[model samples]
Target: MISIRKILCPVDLSKGSLLALKFANAISGRYRASLAIIHIMENPHLDIPGGETGAFSFGELVNLYKEERQEEIIDVLKQKGTHAVDYEIIFKEGVPYKEITDTARNIKADMIIMSSSTSEKSEKVAGATTERTVRFAPCPVLSIKTDHDQEKREKIEKIGDLMDMSPNVKRTILLPTDFSEHSELASNYAIAFAKEYKADLIVLHVIETIAEVSFMSSVDLPGYGTTSIYYDGLLKDAQARVKNICDKAIEQGIKAREYIIYGNPRREIIDIADKESVDLIIMGTHGRKGFSRFISGSVTEAIVRNAQCSVLSVKHPEHNFV
Candidate 1:
């Protein structure tokens, strides 16, 4: 089984950060994994007589801050820590995204436990951090948002149980692809996951929005034979994409099924998930910039918001694609 070992929680020292810390503590307790509490200070500078110094120059100052914060974090851990789990605290200075990501990678953390804040102010901060982590982090990230009210905390706990990843429940993985290299990498991960779980693999592709219907027009029906041929070729191309994905899956020794659907990609993907009764959906998000970020690659965001099942979105590293 895939085990979660070290969980990295990036803190901004906000109340929401503490909530995320609590959630991480719970998981670490359950699984007995090491928890790393990381707080990053962004470009902190102090103006001097001559000029401003780089944030990196304040190493001693940052260390002092971390030491103070670390003590407080340890106190929380002591109150909530279980007898079985072990954890440590870390404080670093750098850009929030870069430091957290680097630390996770350097330590080979199995998962990252962070929070998604809901307050208007917190949401703005979280949205950017979440986007960066989701786009670039090597491991899967779990984001939580904290409300300080006791009643709200209970509500959040209930929601967490419903969504809190349980033990070895992963059985089937749905991989929606556009047949790009990024999709292929995601497929590789899905296959690895399926093999680990002895699970079934579902490969899906949608021919929507971009799908064109072509036929010979009566105005030049006979002359447009080539156009008719091209339309047939398009369908063939779509089928080829599905076939290629299936071939890769089979090569990986995974039991594979492929689906090709027409209509809106988002709607079609969700419909397929419901119809197939899948437990999880693993798909590649193109991470197209500008409006696409808000729309989440047009179809991907739609499926995530609408689907009843769990979704894992994998994006190509900019160095690889962009």
Candidate 2:
């Protein structure tokens, strides 16, 4: 039921953003998802303390920049569109990151596809914009570089309307879970993707570390019954989690299977993806911040760096958790 039916591609009219727009167009053409193109002007209200004295009047400045950026964006869109794809462009004033996130939420977009600068100045090719958008987006965000000659790909009005661009889940899909609410959320997406393509769903949950019992039971136990009991609890819980996920898929009448393993989360996630020959990995992030963010979890970052297949990282809306 969770489908990528609507997509948001926020552009700043940079060459990279334009490349992102083309990529979004390809994906939207494949799935028949609506494309909402957004442009956000940087907020002008804030300045360093006592640094605003020489600033121009707000109204005069606003009108001036608006006319300039709006014209440029319109020209870019006109150049980008072909006869087949339908897209809507939105111009708003606010913080780039906030407005992008807000518009995606308002439109209930299933994904956000954007281009990242591969400029040497950027430490990560994914870029800070891509990272921030991924951190906050309610749906999947595919941050791709401007590769693949666009002149070669055909065009379509809708995503599902085009068979060529339809993703091949049959080849592979990498799923990572921490056994959290949002991890289950990623499972929902992965299951649907697998079902659609009739692909093998390699459901994976890593223990992150060997359990204390497993570590202590180095020597053989007195009876196999007690040892079985110890492992049973962990496996039982994992089975139930996997069952709940599979149940959602079964409701859609799709055949789905699962796997559970023990190891470091990031390494296992990448390893299984490589071993299974997956095309994508769908996982979840908690989006923790500040000191807590610094000291603890960053499975998304690790997997993104190490994964061979594409990674789709999902996070709950802020309100969804609270």
Candidate 3:
């Protein structure tokens, strides 16, 4: 069984953040997890003349801002009726991603939930904070999209209706894998979520035809054969692996299915999710950094950016809470 004791959610007070808060609140209630809602105040570069500096010190201005933000957050939580689960509001000043990740580590958070989109006035590029947090967060990160329907947004405005509008994810969950250790970790989360929501699970593996061609062009190595024979063998092997995973899910009382496709893994994953009307996607990230991340370009990040449904990016934690 999986356990989620603590969840951290960062909000910038945008409509996007409101949408994310909705998910965080609902999931926390479902798991009976403690929730910490944080807001990071970016330093405002005040170019005041020396003469007017005495009117209010920078520290005083920050304090004033924090007071206003606290009131706003309290009102938001009240409107959403977040009394079902234990929750706290934290205010900090610094870089958004750094503060969010640090708070999660400090709280030993089991999960981090936040919006994948940024406000128009944000200084950083769109999705930059979310991308950074996903790469560096100690635990799994679930990012919600802000592009919901107008009707949904309207529903959000109605006080005490948040629980009804929150995502239940009771339809289908999509998990894309390459069968690596990272993918194995993600599979664990996929199974846990499927059981929790009583949702069907779909495991998909995509074989890159370009890689197949590369393999075929190699010199006839020992235990190797013609291209057609090699392709058939590869397909059979993938089927067995995918089926094994589905079998495990079935044993856990989950409705599960497997799929094997030939194409780019990233593109195929997103396309299939749309075709199947998947409610969520759970996948693993290598947490690639610096030059390697730039060169290879993370497939998980690409999917998170493009997928219509929410995405949960899991990384192996030092302590396995789930």
Predicted structure with the largest TM-score when compared to the true one: 3
Give the least accurate 10-residue stretch of model 1, judged by summed lDDT. 42-51
lDDT, candidate 3, 212-280, per-residue tens: 265446444357565556667879989998998899899999999988988787889999998997878
Between candidates 1 and 3, the TM-score winner = 3
Q: What lDDT score is found at residue 186 in candidate 2?
A: 76
* Clash count per candidate: 2, 8, 0
TM-score, predicted candidate 3 vs. hidden true structure = 0.85
Give each model's whole-structure lDDT: 0.65, 0.64, 0.78
Q: After best superposition, candidate 3 residue 295: deviation in angstroms?
A: 3.2
Cα misplacement distance, residue 69 of candidate 3 (Å): 1.1
lDDT of 1 by residue, 1-322 (tens): 3466777888776776766677678777766788888887553344222215443456565555566677767766666334227776776766777888888888877777776554558655754675566556766655553542566566555534533445544456788887777677677667766765566898887765333443443222344346555445556787888788778778878788888765677788888888886766776666565775665454554554455554555655322111
TM-score of each: 0.57, 0.66, 0.85
Off by over 4 Å in 3: 44-54, 80-84, 118-126, 151-170, 211-230
Say which candidate scores most in lDDT: 3
Error of 3 at 284 (Å): 1.1
Colliding residue pairs in candidate 2: 29-159, 30-159, 30-160, 31-159, 31-160, 32-158, 32-159, 32-160
lDDT of 1: 0.65
Query: Which regions in candidate 2 have their CA more than 4 angstroms from the true location?
Result: 2-5, 12-19, 30-32, 39-85, 91-95, 106-108, 116-126, 144-169, 210-232, 243-255, 318-322
